[model samples]
Target: MAIGLFYVILLGCVLLNVCFYFYFSKVCFSNPTTYTKNVTPVSVIVCAKNEEENLKRLVPQLLSQDHPNFEIILINDASTDDTRFVIEEYMAQHPQIKMVDVVNNETFWGNKKYALTLGIKKAVNDHLVFIDADCEPASNQWLSLLSSPLKNDTTIVLGYSGYHKAKNSLLNALIRFETVLAAVQYLGYAMRGNPYMGVGRNLAYTSKQFYDVSGFMSHMKVMGGDDDLFVNEAATGNNTAVVIDPEAFTMSKPKQEWNKWWIQKKRHVQTSKLYKTKHKLSLGLFFTSQIFFFIATILGFLFGLQWEAILSLVLIRYVIVWIVMGKGLSRFRESELIPFFPLLELLLVFLQAGLFISNITHKPSRWK
Candidate 1:
């Protein structure tokens, strides 16, 4: 009887997970929405602190984006380095380049939202695009496609931001896998008119939309949600769009050290805790099902109760995940991780569990 109950729970988990996978699978074969070409003037905002080196490389790419009319606003968030000098040099060379010099206010030191608020206030354009200092556009069309979806009704655009593929590093693979997986969930959800969040690394909104939600003022006290929290509070089926165009992507540097990555994940996890009630419930169910699915697999094998059935169910789940996430990875340019999909997923499950526990005991560290 105990064995039967275990099998039942395992079956339920697989079924639940597969249902979620089926939902995500739609994103692969789905043309969820159609967008008209938008040539509205866009203001590209990037905020940075002590990132003089990254800015030197990233700014050129931002400047090179093939758009009719756009301004690049570089927000130097009180960097102690030569970040201001780099921005000044670029400002002198290109009429399109502008800088927001954020004087260090200890009260908001290292606060990204505060820094970004200053930059956004100074932008002249109504349509806005945001990119990170440590990132480069995948192509000239980045700004073009990312902004094309914007119109009177569509106020928010969620774009994909990927990492540079590092060779022979398991940690790198793990980070990329996790990132693409996240992209899958959020993008898949947005495809169905349910956008919960978006990464700031490559995202867009109208100045009106930003101000509509009071421009991050709702979650101002919390750190590390200048992009996602705003979306959570503001985006809706009527006003949000998802951009998966290959050329529309942005690529950022991933953390190399495990400790650094752990810290980064902690901050992100902390921010997610503030999602709206319905979003929390929906996401919590998906995550809980994931946790139990793996736990059941381990117990099923050890207890030797219908091992064959367990194996079959697990394979079915894996195949579905493989198909869905495989398509996503290919589109996102991280197809090389496909072969290790199952293993990477298992690692992520465990990592997520650890992160949750870590957060319980340790307050999330603020991003600098």
Candidate 2:
């Protein structure tokens, strides 16, 4: 009976993994090829705190975007550093650039969200595009490509944001792989008209949609969710769109220290609890199946029970994952991580499980 149960469990895991691969293959493979030429006026919003160096470097790239009718709004949120000077210098030369400063206040809301609200209130355009101070656009067409869907009635546009490649660090490779995996799910689901969450690093939507959803009021107390949680509540099949165009991508610096990355990831996972029930179930099932697959495979090998079947099942799942991941990486222009996918996949599964447990036990402090 025990042996029979093991077989059933292993088969279930394999099936679940295949189902996930199919979803990725169907949605990501059939990417939108036709892009509209609708160039609408966009208000690009950036919220920064103590990121003086990054603001000086990346904000220029944003200012130099080739889009004709757009403005860049930078919110210097109580920075003890030279963030204000950096913005002022840029604003002096560029008429389209605007700046808002948020003084340090003991408020109940997260600082990032509060800063974003202030920026949105000052925005003069109907469409808003958001990116972090640390992120740089991949090309001049970044704004054009990101905001094109909005011309066609897409209220929410989700774009890919990748990490800059680092030399000689397994951690960097893992970070890039994890990012690609996440893009596969969020983008794929959006393509399938079941949009859930989006990364704030490179996302766009209408100001009307923001006000319609009350602008992060539901998850206001949480440290994060300025992006994902708002989209979770507001996105729908008819209104949300996904953009994987290489020209539309943005690159951000990855966390170098393990502890820093852990804290960042833990804060991110805290907002998952607020996701809709469907999202919760879908993500929970995927993670549970992944954990079971790894644990059961090891136990089956240790006890020398059905090694042949276990190995076969593992190989089948890996093949599907590899093929799907290859397509997703190609689409997102992260094909460099393809060779490291197998190892990174195994590492991320364990790391994600640990992060989930840590998030449940400890609440993350409210900071940017």
Candidate 3:
């Protein structure tokens, strides 16, 4: 009976890798990467609480965007630091830079959504692009490339945001690996016409779509989902698109310490609790199959049960993963992680599972 169940699990993994969960991701894999750019005027919004240092480096890039008619709206989210001063200095120098100063109140003390809404109201252009204060555009064409895909039925455009590579740090590789895997899933799903979430660090949508969904009022009080949760509520198959260009990417610093990164991931997992049920099931199914694949492979080897079958199944899964997802990794500059895929997949699975359990037991606190 145990042997039978193990074979069934291995077969399940192969089927998922095939991704025919409604042709899950095969189309995205087969289609070549392409983007359609519309040179529409846009408002670039950034909300900062205590990101003064990052703002210093990011503002110059914003000022230099290759787009012809773009405005920068910087929201000083009641920072007790030099963030407001930095914004004011830039506003003084450039008419294109606008500021939305937010004061913390009892109702929405650290609510980034609230601050972002005010910035959105301040925006002169109907089309809006959002990036975190710490994120730097990959090139002068970043804004153009990121916003280009948001045309016709495409109201929301999702782009990749990656971390700066650092050497000799296991945490760095783990962070990048996890990031690339996530991009592949979400972007692939979007291409499949079922985008579920997007990174706030490199996302774009029009004011019309924002108002169409009534903005973030549904999940306003929740922490750390201003980007994803909003996308969850607003984005749909016909109205969403993705960009895979390297020049369209955004880069930010990764958390170096394990504890810090853990805390951050813990907070991120909280927002998923509110994801639509179908999306939750789809994402959960893929994740569970991955965990099972790794665990089942080890069990087959250690207990010496059906080694030949296990080896064949493993090869099948790996080959499919490489062929289906390798282009995405190369686009994101993470092809180096392809060799360590098995190990990294195992670590991320166990780590995120533990994180999900911990959050259930004790919720993570809020941050600015």
Tens digit of per-residue lDDT, candidate 3, span 2-102: 89998998888877756733343533354435665567899999999898998999999998988989999999999999999999999999999999999
- Please identify which of the two predictions, 2 or 3, would achieve the higher lDDT against the true structure: 2
lDDT of each: 0.89, 0.88, 0.86
Model 2 C-alpha lDDT per residue in residues 206-321, reported as the tens digit of each score: 99999998998887778899999999999999999888878899999999988988899998888888999999999889888988999999899999997888899999998988
Clashes of 1: 0
Cα RMSD (Å) per model? 1.3, 1.3, 1.9
TM-score of 1: 0.97
Give the residue spans of candidate 1 off by over 4 A.
31-35
Per-prediction backbone clash count = 0, 0, 0
The total of clashing pairs for model 3 equals 0
- Give the Cα-based TM-score of candidate 2 against the true structure: 0.97
Comparing 1 and 3 on lDDT, the stronger one: 1
In model 1, where is the ten-residue run with the lowest total lDDT?
29-38
Best by lDDT: 1
